[model samples]
Target: MTTMIKTVDVTTALSDVDRFCDIPNARISGEIFHRQDIYEQELEKVFARCWLFVAHESQFKKAGDYIATTMGEDDVIVVRQKDGSHRAFINACPHRGNKVCFSESGNARGFICNYHGWSFDIAGNLIGQHESGIYENSHFDASKWGLREVALIDSYKGLLFANFDADAPSLKEYLGPMAWYFDALFDNQEGGTEFVGGCIRSTMDCNWKIAAENFVGDILHAGWTHDSAARAMLGGAVAKVSDFDESYSVNWHGHGYEFAMDTVGNVAVLGESALNKYLHTIKPSVAERLGDFRSNMIGSVSSATIFPNFSFLPGQNTIRVWQPRGPNKIELYTWVLVNKSAPEEIKEKWRKGAMMTFSPTGVFEMDDGENWEYCTKTARGKVTAKQDLYVGLGQESLLQETDLPANVYSGQLNEANSRAFYQFWSDLLKAPSWNDVPNRNVGRVEAGAAAERCSLKEAK
Candidate 1:
């Protein structure tokens, strides 16, 4: 039996998401980018169920250190406790729904609500309130009035993530094979990675998915869209995509990455010679530890998105999350990441270099913002919203003769990753519960295992 879920759309009234997605044909409707009702459903079905990036362990060195961030539109405060464990809670006060914390981050003994003076301990337990004698006659119990705690929280390689859905899989399980690729960037260094400075936030008049899907695998846009910026920084355009013999666009489940074998192409875009030289000096040791496959990727021309909205540029070392502000707008939060073992000078170079190319006011960022904003703004028309946008550029280019995990397409210019991303998006939107959502990568993983076993037997 097939379960058909109807999703709301501005153009078609109520319709199945499959009609809009059209995975086999590689087409999708524009209404998915600008519909208010669809965006509301995504909040409940996608944002609330995913393992969203919240904060990094480097941000909290001692008890009570905390940073206030968002998972979807719901404001949350992730705090370190006395026991050295981390926890997160809703940023709103239990009394009258007032915001408790105003600062972005700080070390505090407790959070006090300005509206009614209700106070909560670092662990989210209600400890005090204004005029205790006044509440003595009421049914208010301090023990039961604590701030609502986030359902689940976990970490991977110093990055902390929180989940609102208790029924969702553990973070490790949720990451699945994507963890294999992440280990190269995050865990390859001896001392691991850390954020360099306070986050820089900016707003864009575009849907979050437009920004996300770009990072996911739209390498085709780089050569044309950012050509001027690339020429300014690197003294030439980004790598030519028509000759993609050594490049791939790979997707695992919903996560996607596109990269080329030009080991220093992305680093060169930062226009910092010291940083580029630094990567070369460390490549041999990385190869010894994680093997050539991941080691060669250390300073490669690559970009990735971890489903829904988090994205990063590997060699440029810019990490960001696109928090959906509304159906047609997003708030982008960005940070520069560097290896903790790096020298002070090298880390400083990384901070400035990344900002020069990817920050809100950077040359590359300016080009992207205009493109995505127009992509969202023009989709608002009734006739324009009904048209299907073509995403089927390289449907016939699937590559299987490789050890790469997940779905690997042969060229950097392919839309395979974008197609895989939308398929997963539709799957999430149409499923009633997590149980109904399918793991689309299972067969690819199994087939890879089978191929590996065959080669091993032949070697004997």
Candidate 2:
């Protein structure tokens, strides 16, 4: 059952979205990350309209295993059903504003509200209550008061996603050619990928988009921000500093991926472990399944963001969600995704490696959070908010001349993906309804073609 979501009116925020992101000029105002008005509009335009990743299917190994997570500002519950299928619902209790499930995640047959004894079954059905309840009217039907279900829920491979809008496109449609890249990372494993560790939650003083955009194509910072960690690990003063090649891709609907041209630099963990051996072992099988293009990415170090907030490091085996808390803060949820058939030692190595590099206590993670915090904090100044940040690193160069699903750039350090990301954000805000979202699914091709023409003109 779909219930209407209550949202704050955002008339001014809609107008500001277009003003903040001027793609042709290569400018995005500082206010987009600092202002409360734009944040409110984002919840309506971006979060509500887009299909957001919720929980991985591997998280629920048995019936009734559920993960309580956040979709946007709203709380959500994703539960494995009696059958193998999965369903997601708003975690809010329908009777009152009280929570039905207090824990973040666990196995549960049913959820009983602590404030009142009103209970709901695993399928979100109103099962019991009324022995001592106030709404005990004999004629009133309690069965009709089930928990509010999300309008749409679907899976791509093993990843589950949910959308609030009933009119939004299907998951496969929204994913588009981005699915091709996903298969390279996810479908390559023999037994497939599964979350092998617990979650690590932390909050940082930064806009959600800042972190999301960084993973897309901001590899330039690795050498600078993670200089110390790189020296300690790779014995090099610079992080991921490669003499070989690297590439960036901007898939439709703002999804992105970047990987080094060489695979060794991406997965330079300890000397030679089972993970390294596993990488070599899977290449032939992956090549047969996905052909030469995708199999190249089997064990390569790559960073990607699935549109809005979901991100994963394929080499590191870390997956994360940058959950938006407000204009200036985000609650980050991280988990380890490892090969299903891997041995216990290999899985443990991946888990511990993620903790050392990407978790809250991670050395590299600490460096990144510091940069993002200051990036957001500095924009709080009135004059700073008026400034236009430059995001035009390879703006004149065309990255679309490719047979792959995503538009590929020559260099990994380019900001082409960031440009596509902000444009997608602004377009979603400018659209009055999902029907009016012209810049999304169908427009990316035309946009790429236009970029190609502009590049040719510049060369002439």
- TM value for model 1: 0.93
lDDT of 2 by residue, 1-460 (tens): 2344433233443555667799888999999888988898889888876889898888888999999998899888889999978888788888786888878899999888876677788888877774745467556576678788887889877889998887787887787766767776788866777888788999999999999999877877887787778677666544443454555555566888777644444556433356677776777777666665566676565678888999988777788999999999999999998778778888888888888889998878999999999999988999988898999987765644554454666667778888888888887888777666665445335433443443354345
Which pairs clash in the backbone of model 1?
Answer: none
Q: Name the regions of candidate 2 deviating beyond 4 angstroms.
A: 1-13, 132-138, 237-242, 269-273, 440-460
Task: Write down the TM-score of every candidate.
Answer: 0.93, 0.91
Query: Quick one: how many clashes does candidate 2 have?
Result: 0
Model 1 over residues 1-460: C-alpha lDDT tens digits?
1111122121222357888789898899998999898898788778877889999899999999999999999999999999999988889988899899989999999999998888888988888788977888897777878888888889999999988877777887777666666766787778899999889999999999999999999988888989988988987655676765588888876788888876677888889899889888888777666666677777787889888898988888899999999989999999988899988998898889877888888989999999999999988999999899999988999876766666788877888889988988888888776777887776576434533453354345
The most accurate candidate by TM-score is: 1
lDDT of each: 0.83, 0.77
Task: Tell me, by lDDT, which candidate is best.
Answer: 1
TM-score, structure 2 vs. true: 0.91
What is residue 403's positional error in candidate 2, in angstroms?
1.3
